[model samples]
Target: MVSRMFRIETGDDKDRRDLLRRRLLETNTAASPVLRALRGTPAERQRPLHLWVMDEADELAGGLVGHTWTTWLHVTYLWVDGRHRGTGLGSRLLAEAERAATERGCDAARLETWDFQAPDFYRGHGYRETGRTEGIPGGHQDVHFHKVLAG
Candidate 1:
């Protein structure tokens, strides 16, 4: 057997990151038939992304971006402009996403929120905190929320 030392690259490199991600996915998929099957599902093969925006004066006010997968709508990002906060736009955006997800055969929605983010706002919209991890970044917490979509 031959032994060799490998050099490690440091700093932000999008190409390297993407290459690593591809390699890891390939390795995982090759090792497990279950993983391959899961990824080959009818719904998994189709990953459509959606972005709902709230615009004012040709400027961005708020938006909801997510993707519906199989049985869950993963809310990637939800942001409302500070001036537009508390105007129910956030709730409306969430409701709109949920509606789209339901139409796509999704039965639930899930998202992760930072401690400084609107976890309470999501809770008010029928999402419940399913998990929490503290000390994420300088005493901050990461909260996971999930909501069942209406059929």
Candidate 2:
């Protein structure tokens, strides 16, 4: 049997902004109870945040949240629905994000994930492990990865 995928496009700036707003609200709703507790209690101010939504079949399949600083494009988060794993959709979304970074003149992309997440998946796509922090809140070390782009 063949599977079908549909892309929902938010065409204009206003539409994209609205879509992002809704996505954030949905993400906050789905986050764990602990995260919800710390949601708005940051002690310090931070840089601007940007969000991109990946919608497939009218549902949110994944999302990319990041910000560009100087020469680097830091990917704060990249998530795909659990049911949609191993479907090539993550790769497609990452490629799109890479293209966007290149267009924005970023020299590289960086992100971090726990061991239980998709470290192997990123490594398969040319990302290299750059740093690691042991014993995070849940006893899992966070691994940082980076992918430098050719101009």
Candidate 3:
């Protein structure tokens, strides 16, 4: 017979985050050994990238937040101020980011938006719907898109 001891803690511990990261990487590597080479990918190769527009005196107007890995740019968030929307600023920001990503050897870009968000706007930028899932609290669904760079 064999016995196992278990302990449960319900709180956030900053120091334990590193332990969780190690465990996650180990489990993934066990599942697929090819992923071992990505041990420090987020810190080394996939460091976050950002683009922003500023008004006079350097006040923030709009911006993007994302990271790149293995020739793919993952757009986590893209936003423009209310005063900047519909003024082409958002399109310019995204286009510039795509150009930069192409220069960095990225082959594609990906992002997600909701039903009420700018999915159609992304389509105008050459992104195409890849997949989607419905059933949010509201009637909105999460939509994912991808665009190939011209590099």
Candidate 4:
């Protein structure tokens, strides 16, 4: 590839040309190691992973996981340790998840909780019941909730 340097600052042609040449050299050197490492590494595939852990007394209180896509954030899993129940940990976890979703540019967050799960907990946090499925031959059905983020 042919390399060329051009001045970018007004009225400082020589200095700008030198600066551009230095920048190009630095960029090429910075990327060479990564390129060489990936030459036999099968293209070095990667994916983004985010993890959050809540702890109490050195024990795991809860955790949440989600994946982001082009236009939406999908919540893959959420759990609060059984010993931490009734301690507001679940609500705090939900709030954290919502904050993360908003930060990731998601306009809304969605999740599902069983009938025997923390329905009231989610309701208290502004999540509204949008759907439900009953008569599953089990003791309880499933409920889904969603919250919209304000601009």
Each model's TM-score? 0.72, 0.62, 0.78, 0.57
lDDT (10s digit) by residue, model 1, range 1-151:
8879789868999988867866776676678775576645443433655655647576888888787765689999988899898898888888888888888778888999997888888888899999999889688999999998889
Our tally of clashes for model 4 stands at 0
Worst 10 residues of 1 by lDDT: 39-48
lDDT of 2: 0.72
lDDT of each: 0.80, 0.72, 0.82, 0.64
Count of steric clashes across candidates, in order? 0, 0, 0, 0
Q: Is candidate 1 or candidate 3 better by TM-score?
A: 3
Candidate 4 lDDT, tens digit per residue, 36-151?
34322211211222455557566667777765432244566678788877787766766666666666555776667788877887788888999998865676878888777654
Best by the lDDT measure? 3
Off by over 4 Å in 3: 1-3, 6-42
Mind giving the per-residue lDDT tens digits that candidate 3 earns over 35-95?
Answer: 5554455334455679988987788999999977647888988999898799999899888
Best-fitting candidate, scored by TM-score: 3
* Deviation of model 2 at 13, angstroms: 25
Better of 1 and 4 by TM-score: 1
Clashing pairs in 2: none
Among residues 3 or more apart in sequence or in different chains, the pairs in candidate 1 whose N, CA or C atoms overlap within 3 Å are none
Instruction: Please give the RMSD to the true structure for each candidate, in Å.
Output: 3.4, 16.4, 3.1, 17.7
Residues 47-122, model 2: lDDT tens digits: 2335445565678887777765434678788888888778887787777777777765667988898999989989
